[model samples]
Target: MLVRIITGIIGITAAAFVIQTGGVVFAGFTLLLMLLAWFEYVRAFSERGMGIALVTGFIALAAMWYAAWQKPELLALACPLIVLVMLLESVLMRGSTSIMDALASGAGLIYIGFPFTCLLQLRGMLPETVFSTEISSFTFGCAFVWIMFIGTWASDTFAYFTGTAIGRHKLCPSISPNKTIEGFMGSVIGTTAVVAGLGYYLNLPLQEMAVLGLLIAIFATLGDLVESVAKRYVGIKDSGNIIPGHGGVWDRFDSVLFTAPLVFYFVQFVNLLGK
Candidate 1:
């Protein structure tokens, strides 16, 4: 427990630093994480006798990250191009591969690449002028990303303690047996409170922050469960053991991966409704 807490604090500090210095630093860090996550993901699948295009998939991953970092709006164009490349590679390896192989490869790209890219998108939030409403402190800053991170962290922390204290009913006994219904509710309530406090401090939209907190709690739990399912299917406890006490990059960022896109679009919806 001590080791895990220490490692987690260090990891969070590093991530916060990168987020605060949002530019090449954050992009490079995210790119590294995306690649490592892809490697861990591919390793898991390959261990199960699933064939994937390694070089081609890496290229696609790099291209997609580049698109996200450099020209986010071109993501629509980049995605189809990636699929086309995957199919082309499948065709070239016709005797040894099928469309399924291409799809599996592409699926990894979408799963890891697209969501990791959302870090960049969330960091570069649309300007208030884009919505034509300068009502509150809705600027293109680190508040949204910080809210997502802190909210998810608070949710997980609250869930852990709550489950340890008085957890009774199982939430998902199959995928994650340790989780409990009491803990899940604790996470939702705890995250909402934390994010609401942050919103008040930062002069952000409190209503949106509260809603986003609930979304974070739910999706963060689902994300952790989904990773648990993946690892259980592969018969592995951790993804890569890259971090000292935490499992891997994927393990650390799993919840953020799920919540990032949700928060991104949810903020847009809030802005739209306001206008």
Candidate 2:
């Protein structure tokens, strides 16, 4: 437990430092994560003898990064191409006559592609007005990402401790045996306090902060649950044993996978509403 905590803190600190520098540092880190995650996903499915899955996965990851960086406007042009490639690959894969396998490949692309794209979009959308004045974009982006990470980490931390301490009734025994309603509520409350406090300290509007906190708390829980369900379906305990204490890349990113898109759309929605 101590090792995990120390490693997590160190990992986060290094990530923050890289994000603070932005430009190549930020892009390189993001690309590395995207590739690693893609490889992991491909490896998982390849065990089922699904050829070309790795190729499709890497292509999707690259497409997302490119879309995020150079040609978001090209998404209209790119989505069809990706679908076509996947469809053709599915046909070429031996024994892909099963509709399920084809669907799984398509689902993997969407699942991995969308959130990966959102990370780039979030970085792209860093408010120039906020960053240009007094604060650097890198600093602001790091701070924003840090706030989101804090919410996720706090919720996970509180839920684990609280669940172990006062968990009497199961929340979803079929999906996650250890989870309890009490733990869920504890996580919500713990994360909300931290998120709201951070917003207040940052001088953000109270109502907006509260709303954002609520959204993060709710969505983050859902994200964790979603990953739990996936793992259950796949008959795995941890995604991978990448970190000493933490699970795999998927385990570390499960919550962020869902939260990234939510954060991106929320920011966009807020900006549009304000305008």
Best by TM-score: 1
Worst 10 residues of 2 by lDDT: 131-140
Question: What are the TM-scores, per candidate, against the unseen true structure?
Answer: 0.90, 0.87
Tens-digit per-residue lDDT, 1-275, candidate 2: 89988988889888778666666677777777777766666666555655436666677778767877778887656666776667776567646534556666667776767776777666655545353324443334455566677777887888889899998999888888898998888888888788778666665555666677677777878888887887766666777777779877878888888777876777666642234
The regions of model 2 sitting more than 4 angstroms off are: 47-52, 94-98, 131-140, 271-275
lDDT, candidate 1, equals 0.82
- lDDT tens digits by residue: candidate 1, 1-275: 89898997888789878876777898898889989998888888777777777777788888888888888888889888888888787789888767877888887788888888887778777534322234344345466777778888998999999998999999999999999999999999999989888767765678877888888999999889988988887788888888988888888888877888888778776762344
Please identify model 1 stretches exceeding 4 Å from their true place: 126-139, 272-275
RMSD, each candidate, Å?
3.6, 2.9
Per candidate, the number of residue pairs that clash is: 0, 0
